[model samples]
Target: MAKSTRGRVNAQGDGTSGLGMVVRFTPKARSEGVQQLEKGGFRVASSKDFRSAVAVPNDFDGADVQYFERFGIAIVRRDGERLKPMLQNAMQRKVISAARPERSYRALGGPQTMRLDLAQVGGVATSLDRDYLLGYRDAVNELVDRLLGKKGAEGLVARAAFDETSNTWGLQAIRAIEGDLSGAGIKVAVLDTGFDETHQDFVGRSVTKKLFATRSSEGDVHGHGTHCIGTACGPLRPTSGPRYGIAHEAEIYAGKVLGDDGFGTDRSVIAGMEWALDEGCHVISMSLGAATQFGDAPSDDYEQIGQVCLDAGTLVVAAAGNESSRPQQIAPVGSPANASTILGVGAVDRPFVPASFSCGGLNPGQEVDIAAPGVDIFSSLPDDKYDRWDGTSMATPHVAGVAALIAQSDPKFRGWALWARLIQLTKPLSSPARDVGKGLLQARGSGEV
Candidate 1:
């Protein structure tokens, strides 16, 4: 299975590499902004929820890109000298938040060692194979950069690392206050690869599954979703090993946004989010993200989506990303998770020490909300298997599971109230807020709400 990895950008000028730019219109100006762009001779491809549009500029110099009605954003293709001035003009007029030449996102995951036989799965053909998977990842990265940009997205790539463990330290980390709260009646959604319906661990569990990735099946061949679901809602008494899951009794909504190769575009992810929200899920756990540098802003689309979810009484939690090498290079929180309204989770060890791979909040909107046991954490996988992995991906589900427990503790606590309660009930660590926001997460006891 693929582990969470970072995405890289090639900023070199390559004029003919990609399609035209992507323009994100302001919330209030969405209706009129399209008209304004169209009148200016820009060829609009498609508009997503009136928030963003992909267009080809008719006359780059004569377009007057800065004269839009409201605050908007444009991500143009790398057209050498032609692109730089447009970016400068947009930035100077403040019409767009930021502008940069379009670049491709490359997955850091190394080469594939084996290929799976797709024949057995019927005529299903996905990019799970090594070469096709990389190409698919490239396209997804380009879409993400055009739509969300570097700072606005995370968990789009996966690293080539894995480890095994026998103990479930994540459950023990928050067990002090967990008590008997079993997350009953709460709807927890895990949006990643598909789930393994045939897995013995989840045979009798209540799971609502959906597939959004292209040409992808309804089962988890990538193992990312199954592992995350295991941490969030695995059984209390498993076939082997100690208890690893958090919300043992919570309802599971498994939405397959990422394909079996552990890669997906923003379209699939957004669709999965919409499905989860429509289902009235109390908590949505996204253990995926793209890499982001320090001092990068969050994506406007994701920010708006998160705020909408909050208003609708649902909490979205995402991984802060694993791009930091510590003491040398530290990355900021990744997109979707970087959104101010979204809860960003960082990884920690059983000893309460921040993981070396966990990212920190060096920028304004990239702060980590809380920490959870991610290093060598044991959880369920596909094929009735168990494995341990390390990444902010592993840590995110712990927080989600705890959020389920918290939401179940007090029905009145929803959205912002639930966010506030989780923050208030944490075990404060001595680390800086940039590293661990509030501190390590803790579940509510039987008597406490």
Candidate 2:
């Protein structure tokens, strides 16, 4: 943890990462205090109601309050009304913390070679010159690799450990090739843009889905979610490509939190978390993130939500946002993933080197917890198509799927139990813990007794 970023959490959001306010209850509210909730002036939202709580339904004079019983949290919204009185009233008894603005987080990856449009990544600053330089430098490096046998910063080993004849290089690198491919009884929630519910590859698999974001339905138009889902819980043997998925038998719970345009607010993200818990999902995999600045504190609301969710027996795995142009700059891990309890995942390439854009734990307590193959990774996309992409976003699901396998292999793996085992199973790399954390992820092989 860096000294500059240490200290009290910015639970108020600071309106930098997002807009709208999210309220978390104190420990006292855990007793199911109906009176405290009622007096706080909020009604329990229906389990099926995944609407944005910030939209003040019916022109209420003050703030519109909706209490979600599942998480013991409230969302208060006032379109144009005074908020101090209402907030003070709740803060007096029910609200432990309240934050402003709901950040609009985006899908964290795109085309294989540094294709991130820095402008859309909001909050995380990276110059256009840096992006151009990254591309030019990488191009020159590739040219060098071609002219003079494969050699670069990582240097040439006897032979690189990558080939996709039998499976995707990612699966091979992580040793998921021979690992447990069956997560039969485990339920994994992939909370993102949603999955291709009707994609040909998933024909007969049991996939449950819901729309937390206001979209026509839960189908994904942004391809990123489909790619992520395919990695976490796609088919054991795809219709065409080499084996790319893990936990093929794991029941898929697809929650559409980010919409078609690849953007969603904090409200939708939290709603997805609550729904995943309500469905008893064993693992929640999020490949989305809101940008964060150096020394910027993480959301206390998210921190509390993460702790509560973990205690409830579900582990949340999220991407360490691709907000860096390393060597030139390294950014802090983004929100939700930076929420201490959530497993923050970073990206590594074929050489086991950290991806250029992979964010680091520059902020206090925001360290990367794990690493997985994320660069030039092949996986399913929407409409039955497939392609390679890059980002820490790609690494997260690899960890989530593996966690599901661990959960199925042993019934006791949940929350921190699962968290610890995953860390314990990693293969140490040369990279710093700040970049690769515990190290490269290795599946608890199917052959393991």
Candidate 3:
């Protein structure tokens, strides 16, 4: 084995010397005390629930001593002897770094892209060490395993109702277009948390392309996007007939714009949008929103990219948001959703009743476009763990899928034509405030599409 030396790690802090392999440990084995040295000369700098931070002794000339704490244990100093096995064994202990402390943000992606502010406080360190960090890799594998199982299909179908055996809406939507029909032949892009690429629904499915705005390519660290994709166009498995997606056969390009923590930045999102456009996706579905607003319309960043998509014959769909209440707290519709051409979608429950949490119209006039069944909607999940989640994040895809269906049903319609067709097909809502603009999403005249 190559000789080991104590030195700096990667910018992300994997603990590798410039010329040596970085050491790592399994989560279960990270706590064993590797060495114990007296603490008389050190100053305890901080303390947290599990570990205590201490400044190394000024005279700490050797690398033989080990340090201990609840969060992690490590060898801080060693004698003049070369540390081959010592360094290799030290890798078994959770390797902590002065920079890039472990947090969910780092694993999902770096904080800069996610837009989270990290203020340094003298106290407990981050939970993730190299091994636990590597656990994300295992976590992703577990998700794939679950997605590959038979229950994966049943899990999504079960979301229609708590106990209902029938996936009525999902079934109806699939039947509307079951055969060989090229609808618009448009690319539908889904920018959400992540997706289980191993799911049978997506097996052999053409991923015209995919890009992770974050560091990892793991499937939905959270279920938001997975569920949305299922609603938009989860493939048809053998056992699960007809209860797949609104645009069951349409091609899907997934962009992981959000982190496992389900929070991401305007920059990362813009990057995702740009990638989707570059990939030639015809329609972009974003089941995400930002509370921060710009001027009367979307900011330049939102407008610029959205316009590019629109100009390129791509339609952008965004969630109206899930932050509405009395006196009407408007969260500005945000970014691409607020762009002139992009469609901002609101949410209504299964019974067609406007959901109280659904964000209201951007302005007093007819600003918000359509509403869809978002309340506790059932859809696919990561790791094959299925559950119903309620959010406009769930609502936006319904409309995107509808857009895809329209594109497939009427191939002649491109950019604006598809946009206009969807608006014209929707049924107006009884409550003006509840269903601000065009109202509930409906395409095929009184018949199911």
Which candidate should be chosen as best, given TM-score against the real structure? Answer: 2
Query: Which is superior by lDDT, 1 or 3?
Result: 1
List pairs with backbone clashes in candidate 2.
Answer: 18-101, 18-103, 19-101, 19-102, 20-101, 20-102, 180-446
Lowest lDDT sum, 10 consecutive residues, model 1, at 1-10
Score each candidate by Cα lDDT. 0.66, 0.75, 0.53
Report lDDT (Cα) of residue 257, candidate 3. Answer: 68
The order by descending TM-score is: 2, 1, 3
> Candidate 1: what lDDT?
0.66
Worst 10 residues of 2 by lDDT: 1-10
Question: CA lDDT of 81 in candidate 3?
Answer: 30
Ranking by lDDT: 2, 1, 3
Best by lDDT: 2
Alpha-carbon runs more than 4 Å astray in model 1: 1-25, 28-167, 176-178, 446-449
- Model 2, 96-153: lDDT tens per residue? 5443444677888876644544654478765455346545655665565567675422
**Per-residue error (Å), model 3, residue 39:** 53
Count the clashes in each prediction.
Answer: 7, 7, 12
